[model samples]
Target: MTVHTGAPRWWRATTGIAVPCLVAAACGVMLWSSAAPVVDFVYFMLAGWALVLLGIAWLVLVVIGWFRYRTVRRTLLAPAVVAPAFVLVTAALVVVQAPFRLGFLVSKPALADAAADCTYSLEHRRIGVYSVRSTREFDGGCLFFTQGGLIDSVGIAYLPEGVPHLGAPRHDGDIGYDHIGGDWYRFVERF
Candidate 1:
């Protein structure tokens, strides 16, 4: 009886790279999905089902591979090889430095063009020019909450061209304002 010593070189190269890439892509998708809920909301019917199918396929493959092979090392190495790449890619994506802030849209009128004249109002609070042709709204209003705010309300505006970094909030309940929480240079993107 012959025991397989290791995965074939081609298998290592292909699955090692491809599996991690797929998993990395999945991670990116998952991250973006969290930051942008529109996907789950709009594509939940089809994309959600597709995600379930992908998950099922993954489980089936795991079971088949486990039954076909006796060693855990062989069964797991293919996916493991890509783990570093996943971390590297994810980190690169998360840590990108930008001089300008990126705003994500959180609410309705999904079909509107990336507008320069958009406005947002919450109750009596008004946030005008919250977005522009240059400033993009991805997913939906994900960044609006962080962009501008009162203690209870948040606002954001996009300059059609570009503008100086607007001052942080000084007074309470001011539209297009927010109290500075940290270093303005390092703006963290949150969901």
Candidate 2:
């Protein structure tokens, strides 16, 4: 059996802690700055910078440990672990956050108008019309919208004719989409 020892142990522990923190920091930067419609470029830049930092940290540790212990490289220097770990974490992050990010972008146009509707009548749960057309499947509470400052949420329950463009209302206590003239629209929590 092999075990991490001496500097290699410290190096591995430090990298393990830092890698997650760097990833989380990158996600934070992306979410916080991504509200702007034009923030895609900036978000990419921030992500790239974060990746560079991660790579630098990893490389520095590998090189230092490789020169110091020599045996460390044989055990820890596996591209299979590094590459697959990176891909898995990245995929997980994207899959988890894609809905919220897409929802934010889609609703940005209606934000101002939605905010305005909240002041005069705040008693109503219904906001306004919402439209959704997706090539991907959505569950209950998938899409959210805001109108006149009022916010509402809906989701796609069914797709008739196997068409993503055509969705039907659901009774699962969630809003669904309707197809009208090849377009999807949600109105007042109904399709």
Candidate 3:
């Protein structure tokens, strides 16, 4: 085996210690930032791609170091493996979580209002008539309105066959039709 003796002690120490630490720190920062609501989806996508590329490059460096330097191979190995793995995992998570976060970001205001109305109607049981037609964001459905203009219960159908339109009770006491694949309105609900 060929020995590499010209390398500086500081260089070996920095590569062995500092690089891995920096990579870990960067991964932590990326993970923490990705969870922030204010960050845009586009930013996440871009950052994810960038991290993936960086990981790939770091992996290449690790392979080259393994072949070229006997003394420093161990020094270069840990960061080379761990950094890329951490970065790739973080990138994947950020990409996967983007859609749900974007959905919340773009959710229609009408859905929020309808959900609030449904909650109030259900809790008070004084419903009269309540309904919300499905939008691109939320499923279309109707709720039963009791005598006191409060909602009694809610039923929503996901992606109904027809185009989305406002639906009201056909008659004063009508609770409206129930459909499948939709969620029942709840007081505290997530998107």
* Top candidate, metric lDDT: 2
Clash pairs (backbone) in predicted model 2: 113-148, 114-147, 114-148, 114-149, 115-148, 115-149, 116-148, 117-148
Instruction: Estimate the TM-score for candidate 1.
Output: 0.35
Q: Write the per-residue lDDT of candidate 1 for residues 93-143, one digit (tens) a residue.
A: 534511112223332233123233333422232123232112334223222
Better of 2 and 3 by TM-score: 2
Instruction: RMSD for all candidates, in order, please.
Output: 11.0, 12.7, 13.6
Query: What is the TM-score of each predicted model, taking all chains together?
Result: 0.35, 0.39, 0.37
Candidate 2 lDDT over 99-165, as tens digits, reads 3456444654453244333223223343222233221223311223322111233322222233333
Error of 1 at 40 (Å): 7.1
- As a TM-score, model 3 comes out at 0.37
lDDT values of the candidates? 0.37, 0.43, 0.43
* Candidate 1 global lDDT: 0.37
| Candidate closest to the true structure, highest TM-score | 2
Positional deviation of 140 in candidate 3, in angstroms?
A: 13
Candidate that beats the other on lDDT, 2 or 3, i.e. the better one: 2
Go through the candidates in order and give the clash count of each: 10, 8, 11
lDDT of predicted model 3? 0.43
